[model samples]
Target: MKAAVLREVRTPLQIEDVQINKPGPHEVLIRTAAAGVCHSDLHFIEGSYPHPLPAVLGHESAGVVEQVGSEVRTVKPGDHVITCLSAFCGHCEFCLTGHMSLCVSPETKRGQDDEPRLTSKKGPMMQYLNLSSFAEQMLIHEHACVAIRKDMPLDRAALIGCGVMTGVGAAMHTSNVRPGDTVAVIGCGGVGLAAINGAAIAGAGRIIAIDMAPGKENMVKAFGATDFICAATSADVVKEVIEMTKGGVQHSFEAIGLSKTAEQAFNMLRRGGTANIIGMIPVGQTITLMGAAFLGEKRIQGSLMGSNRFPVDMPRLVDFYMSGKLHLDDMISRRIKLEDVNDAFTEMKTGAVARSVIVFDA
Candidate 1:
C-alpha cells in the first residue's frame, strides 16, 4: 500500500510503498476513501507536537471496511466507517464511567513486544493517532472506528471524524451553549466555522466569529456567525467582543490554540460565563489568567476531541449533514491525491484552505 510517510520533522511527507499487516483479534482493515488534512496534522509536521519518526500522519478519515478480525462484531467486512483516534478499551475505568475519550488502557494498542501494524522496506513505521488514513489502507483497532450510513459522502464524513466532531461537540457538549445564549469563537478555520455552525444548531442567539483573515468573514457569516471580528485590526480583541455583545458573550471558545487567543477567549466571556479551549496548544506553554477572573464565576476549561463519544455522536453528525443542517461542502476547499500531501501541508501553513482532502482510489 502507498502511504505518505513523515521521515523527519519540518520536512515533506514522502510517498512510499508501505506494508500493512492483517487485522488482529480486535482489529479492522479499512480501505481508505477520504482523509481530511487538518491543522492537527500540520502541528506534528511543524514540530508543535512531537511523535515517533517515519510515521503515517492522518486521523480525520472515512473508509470502507475491507476486512475485520475474528473478534470484531460492531462492523462487518462491507461496512463504511469513520475512524477516530480515541480508541478506547471498553473495560477501562474511563469507558465504564462514560468518558471513553479519555480511555488510555494499554489494551487499546498492541504490546511493545508485538509486531507493528505498519512497516516499510526500512522497518516498522509508527502509526499516527491509531488510524493513519494517509495510506491506501489502515489497520486499526475496531474501537477506533464507528460504522456510519452508506449514503453519507466519504469526503464529508471524513470531517466528522475530527474537526467537525471537535468543533460541534465543543459547542454542543462541552460548553452546552443554549438557545438565546451568545457565543464567541476565536479562529475561523474549519473547526471554528463548525463551532459557529454548532452554536447555530444549538440555537445561540448571537454567534461571533473572530479571525485574522479578512477573506473569511463572508464564509464565516454563512456558517452561522451573526458577527465577525478581524483580530488583525483590533488592538484588543476582548474589548471589541465585549463591546459587540454589549458586555461579553455568555460563552467563548478558543479554537486557534494560541496563548493570546486562549486568554482572549476567557476575557471575552461575560460574568458567570464559561470559556472552552478547543485548540491543541503546544506543550510547555503556560497561560496565565487574571486572579480576579474567577471571582465573577468565569471558568476556563479544556475540551478533548469535543468530549466525544464517537459511536453515538458521529452518527448524529452524519444525520445532521444529511439533513442539510451541517455545512460541510463549503468547508472542503480542495481534494488532492496522496502524493500532494506535502503541498497540502504548505497550504495549511498559509491558512488559505479550509480543508484539503486526500481522496484515495479504490
Candidate 2:
C-alpha cells in the first residue's frame, strides 16, 4: 500500500509504499476511500505537535470495511464507516461516564511488544493516530470508526470524521450553545465554519465568523454566520466583537489554535459565557489571560474532538447531512489523489480552502 510518510519534522511527507498488517481481534481493516488534509496533520508535520518519526500521518477519513477481526461486531465487511482519532476502550471510566472522547486507555492499541500495525523496509512505521488514513488502507481498532449510511459520499463523510465532528461537537456538547445565544468563532477554516454551522443548528441568534481573510464572508455566511468580522482589518477584534454584540457574545470559540486567538476568544465572551478552545495549540505555547476576567465568571476550557461520543454522534451527523441540514457540499474545496497530498498541505497553509480531500481509487 502507498502512504504519505513523515520521516522528520519541518519536512515534506514522502509518498512511499508501505505495508499494512491484517486485523487483529477487535480491529478492522478498511480500504481508504477519502481522507481530509486537515490542519491538525499539518501541525504534526511542521513539528507544532510532536509524534514518533516515520509515521503515516492522517486521522480524518472515511472508507469501506474490507475485513474485520474475529471479535469485531460493531461493523462487518462491506460497511461504510467514518474513522475517528478518539478511539476509546468501551469499558474505561470515561466511556462508562459518557465521556468516550476522553478515553486514552491503552486497550485501544497493540502493546509495544506486539508487532506494529505498519512497517517499511527501514523498520516499524508508527501510526500517527489510531487511524492512519493517508495510506491506501487503515488497520484500526473497531471502536475508532463508526459505520454510517452507504448513501453518504465517502469524501464528504471523511470531513465528518474529524473537522465536522470537532466543530459541531464543540458547539453542541462542549459549550452547549443555547437557542438565541450569540457565538463568535475565531477562524473560518473547516473547523470554524463547522462551528458556525453547529451554532446555527443549536439556534444561536447571532453567529459571528471571524477570519483574517475578508474573502470568506460569503462562504462563512452560507454556513449560518449571521455576521462576519475581518480580523486582519479590525483594529481590535475582541473589542469589535464586544461592540457588535453590545457587550460581548454568550459564547466565543478559538478554532485557530494560537495563543493570541485563544486569549481573544476568552476576552470576547460575555459575563457567565463559556469559551471553548477547539484548535490544537502547539506544545510549549502558553495563553495568558487577565486575572480580573475571572471575577466576571468568564470560563475558558479546552475541547478535545468536540467532546464526541463517535458511535452515537457520527451516525446522527450522517443523518443531518442526508436531511440537507449539515451543509457539507460547500465545505469541500477540491479533491486530489493520494500522490497530491503534499499540494493539499501547501494549500492548507494559505487558509483559503475549507478542506482538500484525498480520494483513493476504488
Candidate 3:
C-alpha cells in the first residue's frame, strides 16, 4: 500500500509502497477513508516528540473496516469507525477505574519477539502512535477504534478522532466547566475552536477565544466564543482576561502548549478555578508557575486525549455534529490527497488553517 514514511526527523514525509501485516488475534484492518492533519503529528516531525523513525505518521482518522481478526468482536468488516491513539487494555487498573486513556498495558501491542505490523524494503516500519492512518490501510488493535453511525461523513468524523476529542473532552470532562462558568481558551486553531465550541455546549456563561491573529476573531466567534482577544495586540493576556471577566474566569484552557501560554492560563483563572493544559509541551521544557498562587486554591492539571473514553464519546460527538451542534463544517480549511501531507504540515506551522483532511480514493 502507498503510505507516507518519515525516515528522519525535521524532514518531509516520503510517499512509498510499504507493507502492512495481516491482523493479529485482537487486531482489525481498516481501509483509510479520511485522515486529518493535526499539530500533534507535527510535534514528532519537528522532533518535539520522539518516535522510532521510518514510521507511518497520522492518528486522527476515520475508515472502513476491511477485515477483523478472529478474536475481534467490537467491530465487524465494513463498519465505519474512528480510530483513536488511546488504545486501552480493557482489564487494566486504569480501564477498570474509568481512566482508559491512562492505560499502559503492553498487551495492547505485539511483543518484541513478534513480527512487526508493518515493514518496507529497508526494514521494519514503526507505527506512529497506534493508528498510522496516513497509509492506505491501517492495522491496529480493535480497541483503538470504534464504529460510528454510517451516515456521518468520514472526513468530519476524522477530526473527532483527535483534535475534536481533545478539545471537547477537555471542556466537558477534565475541567468540568459548568453552565454559568466563564472560559478563556488560548490559541484559536482547530483544538482551540473546538474548546470554545465545547464550552458553549457545556453552557458556559461567557467564552473568550485568544489568539495572536486578529483575523481569527470572526471565525472564533462563529464557533461559540462570546468574545475574541488578539494576543499579539495585548501587552498582557492574563491581565486582559482578568479585567474582561471583572476578576478572572472560572476556567482557562491552554491549547497552544507553550510554557508562556500555560502560565497565562493559570494566571487568568479566578480563585478556586481550574486551568487545563491540553497541548503537548516539548520534552524537557519546564512550565513554571507562581509559588504563592497556590494559596488561592488555583489548580493546574493536564488532560490526555481530553480524558476520553473513545468508545463512548466518539459516537456521541458524531451525533453532535450530525444534529448541527458541533461545528465541524467550519473546522475543515482544506481537503487534500495523501501525497499532499507535507504541505499540510507546512500550513500547520503558519497557524492559519484550522484543519486539513486527506481523502483517499475509493
Give a tens-digit lDDT track for model 1, residues 25-80: 99999999999998999889889899999899999999999999999998999899
- Clash totals for all candidate models: 0, 0, 0
Q: Evaluate residue 169 in candidate 2 and report its C-alpha lDDT on the 0 to 100 scale.
A: 95
lDDT of 3 by residue, 3-22 (tens): 99899999999999999999
Name model 2 segments beyond 4 Å from true.
Answer: none
For every model shown, what is its TM-score relative to the native structure? 0.98, 0.99, 0.99
The worst-scoring run of ten residues by lDDT in candidate 2 lies at 45-54
- Residue pairs clashing in model 1 are none
Candidate 2 lDDT over 1-362, as tens digits, reads 99999999888999999999989999999999999999999999898888988999999999999999999999999999999999999998899999999999999999999999999999999997899899999999999999998999999999999999999999999999999999999999999989998999999999999999999999999999999999889999999999999999989999999999999999999999899999999899999999999999999999999999999999999999999889899999999998899999998999899999999999
Q: Candidate 2, after superposition: displacement of residue 217 in Å?
A: 0.3
* Local distance difference test scores for all models: 0.92, 0.95, 0.94
List the RMSD of every prediction in angstroms. Answer: 0.9, 0.7, 0.7
